[model samples]
Target: MNAMVQSTVPASRTRLPRKERELQILDIAHARFAEHGFGAVTMDEVAAAAGVTKPLLYAYFGNKERLYSACMERAGDAMLAAVGAAVAAATGPSEALRDGLKAFFAFVDGDRDAWRVLFDETLPAGGELARAVAEYRDRLLALVAQTQLELIPEHSRERAATEVEALSNALLGASEALARWWLRTGALPAAEAADLLVATVEPGLQARAALRDRTASPSTPDRDQGAP
Candidate 1:
């Protein structure tokens, strides 16, 4: 009788535990969101893709907003955790930045599709989606800005904070664009891409710092005096 009952049960019908099922749904939803953007991807599609019922999806995620938030949260958590670990392991601010960059490039190189899913323009047409995207980017820039603050010399730290923050933001934008270009070219390795970024930006920041000091020096004539 036990053998007969076991034979009658289909393996596909077995219920997956809650955590496992949630992961499966997220995996499918991520792919759908990547392909169709959040606005176009319906809960029904994800449920069907994951072989789960609509009610089950709702039971786990409440609604599309929460579901999307959960997905973005996971990606953001993983990214920050990796970058944080790399930065924490470094002995100095420069090494911290280098480690963070290496981790970032390595992540994208290893999982381009995952990176695109997080950064792509397929977000649902809602304020929630906008907030989600902004949260990821803002946190990332915050990390870099913090690193910049750490790198400043003690005497200049107070006055340089604002400029460093602005510079960090610019660096983040430029690096994002450069990484996309590197992806297109696909010739340089991830480490090389990071090395190139550090080499280029470090000197640029130094030059800007030197210029600021020169312009602010006491010997410099006031521009209003026409001392050229």
Candidate 2:
């Protein structure tokens, strides 16, 4: 059967889905926020960069704070999903950590601007935008804590849940500092950054995981138990 072939539309003129267009605008906004601080960036700037009218931009996000919040929310969602997918796809705990770190570094390297938006203090200290970024950070810490709970044996997890959560937060904080340094230095490859985290954490993680397994194992009964 013969079918009619549709002519290709120009990408520039193509009408993207609402969410897709929103993402396109956010990408430009991320770059703008990175170059100029969030406070300095304006809807006009984002609109011009995104090649959309100011009215269209406003229609999508309402106002500057909302627009910035949307960008941060999107960035966080993408980053968390990337690392979570990496961890879920791994065959084992250690491999999960490695893959997750690799995915994180990849995300950071791929979108340094987005990273800046998420972590940049130059944004308003108290506002909806700041709150959005903070919530993302809290979720990142929660992701670490939840992952630990999922992979550990129940017996060990019960005893160590609080300690593990605290450690997870500390580790995340250190990782964030190192990431900032990595960005500033600009010398380390993404793989090396990931390797640093895996090397630093894997041995301790494995040791604890081994302990969990041992603790959860059933003990053998004594041969003379009945004679006592």
Candidate 3:
């Protein structure tokens, strides 16, 4: 009787748990958004692709904007976590930057769809969504700025904060641009891409540190003049 009752249970009754089903829907929606920009994808298409009814999808996510927001949040958090871990394990600021860049590129290479979702230019320009994206960017900016600050001498860090922030912004912007280019043209592998970025930026950073050192050093009196 128990076996018969189990056999008679409908497939819907045996559906995935709510959390699992939500993940499944998110995965499908992420891919769809990656392939087609935010403006192009429809919730119906996502529901069909995810093998869930539209009402069930709505029940899980509330609406398409929320769904896209969820995808972006997941991708952004994953990326930050990857870079943070890599940076934390590094021995020094230089290694931190290098490892962080490598981690960023690796994450993008491992999941290009997530990359697209996070970086899609077509995303709404102003709203809660925009603020959410900005918050992620700000977090990344803070991470990069912290690393850059370490490159400066401890005594000079206070005055150099603004400059370091600017440089961090530049590096972050360049990295994003390079990532987009890499996605469009797979010429360099992820590690090679990271190396290239480091090669291009490291020299300038080193030079800036040397300049700061020179500026911070006190001038010495010419004692040799009296001896001569």
Candidate 4:
């Protein structure tokens, strides 16, 4: 082909298909929503960054809140998948819990903005995004409860369930708090965060075991008389 003929071609006219354009908008919107809270980021800004107009952005997402919610839903789903897979691969409950915790901290460490949007209370209130976060949080609590039951002695299952719920809430709060702190200071590594959780949880588990033993032991009563 001649150089003049090649120059005459109109830049290949590359255009993204509809699905691709929608995905591109969502990608840009995800970054924006993560960096700026759901209420703070504007559709116009997302559209501008995505090289589309506001109407096109709306066509894909309907509104700002909907867009933010979709981004949050995606993040929540990803986090759940990672944690669930890690837990499933473990051989024991302790290892499963550790793996799940590691997955969560890993995500937080890698994507601080997503962590904040998913966790931070100041972002907004009463939305699909908040509901998604709550749903994931509940699922994690359930996993912790099941893991605790598995680790506990059969006779102590009832008490273990309650204690595990409390412990799970505490661990969740602590991990989230540490994550926020790390966002500002970058002091602790993700592995260190996992270690901290295990260090805190293991001793508690041992103590609970001792208590169960004390409670379940045969009482020194006048059983020789065979009184029912």
RMSD of each: 3.9, 8.8, 5.2, 4.7
Candidate 2 vs 4: which has more TM-score: 4
Would you list the clashing residue pairs of candidate 3? none
TM agreement with the true structure for every prediction: 0.81, 0.77, 0.87, 0.81
**Reference-based TM-score, model 2:** 0.77
Model 2, span 1-228: residue lDDT tens: 123333353356568899899989988887788878777988888898888899999999999889878778877898999888998898876677778778888999998887887887787778787778778888888767766665677767888888788878877887788889899998799889889977988778768777878756667345568623
What is the per-residue lDDT of model 1 for residues 1-228, given as tens digits with 9 covering 90 to 100? 999999998788558899999998898887777667777889998998898899989999999988878877777778878888888899987798889888888888876766766776666555877788888889999888877776665556678888988988898887788788888898899899999999888776666656666766778898889987
Total clashes in model 2, counting residue pairs 3 or more apart in sequence or in different chains: 0
The 10 consecutive residues of candidate 1 with the worst lDDT sum are 149-158
Residue pair clashes in candidate 1 = none
lDDT assessment of candidate 2: 0.81
lDDT of 1 at 11: 82
* Local accuracy by lDDT, each model: 0.81, 0.81, 0.90, 0.76
Which of the numbered candidates is closest to the native, going by highest TM-score? 3
lDDT, candidate 3, equals: 0.90
Q: Highest lDDT: which candidate?
A: 3
